[model samples]
Target: MLALQPVDTVAPAFRPEPVTQEEAAAMFRAALGLFGKWELTDDQAATLLDMPVRTYRRWKAEGPGRISRDGCARLSNLMGIHKALRIIFAEARRGYGWIKAGNDAFAGSSALDVMLGGELTDLMRVRRYLDATRGGW
Candidate 1:
């Protein structure tokens, strides 16, 4: 008869600390120094970025390779608004439920127009309206 071996499982310890700009520069330099030494999985890459599987799929379908935080979020928001507006316009033309849908389509702009004198486009229209009407938010 042969003796059975027991499995040993232990998780690695990690500590988190805020990185200053100088620390960030040095850390990135050190990490980059070990290029092609460590092997990483596709799942590991996605997991490291905290991306959802579905979001990763859509992004990969668009183009291969890594995606940036700001660019991806901005593109996703624009695409969502575009699709919604298309549906709203189609429904409005067919004479269905335009009253509520149209009301808040441009909440910031409409509110700004209501108050008047928002010549500058750089400013947040809703915030500008609030500043003009009330003190400030």
Candidate 2:
């Protein structure tokens, strides 16, 4: 006769709160600031955000409006990547410079280049790379 032991299931400890419109707007504004710090042109920023160039320009000039969930996600990933870079490099300039610097991990392409793939997953990939490099989530 064989006895079967019960398996214990554990729930996740952390659950994120739903993002509010204000929070989304704030993230959009912050992403614009990050673009300036990273010296990303409008086209590059739009590409990274997975938005049309016209929309990006409009948002930049008129202010944050109707940021979709996917757009917020892209902004969040960009912020996460920036934070990881800040933690990894003591100098802020170094962190900014690193975005455009070639890396073997990205197949000799800059992190910005990888992110310019114009997909939400592309932004996430850069964030994941930075997180892994810095030994953080």
Q: Top lDDT: which candidate number?
A: 2
Supply candidate 2's per-residue lDDT for 68. Answer: 82
Give the range where candidate 2 is weakest over 10 consecutive residues by summed lDDT: 10-19
Q: Write the per-residue lDDT of candidate 1 for residues 7-71, one digit (tens) a residue.
A: 76776678755444454334333322211122223343234224565654554454433434433
Predict model 1's lDDT versus the native.
0.35
Off by over 4 Å in 2: 1-15
lDDT tens per residue, model 2, 1-137: 99999887987789888788899888889989999999999999999888889999999999978878888888889889989999999999999999999999999999989898888888889889889989986
**Among these predicted structures, which one has the highest TM-score?**
2
**Model 1 reaches what TM-score against the true structure?**
0.23
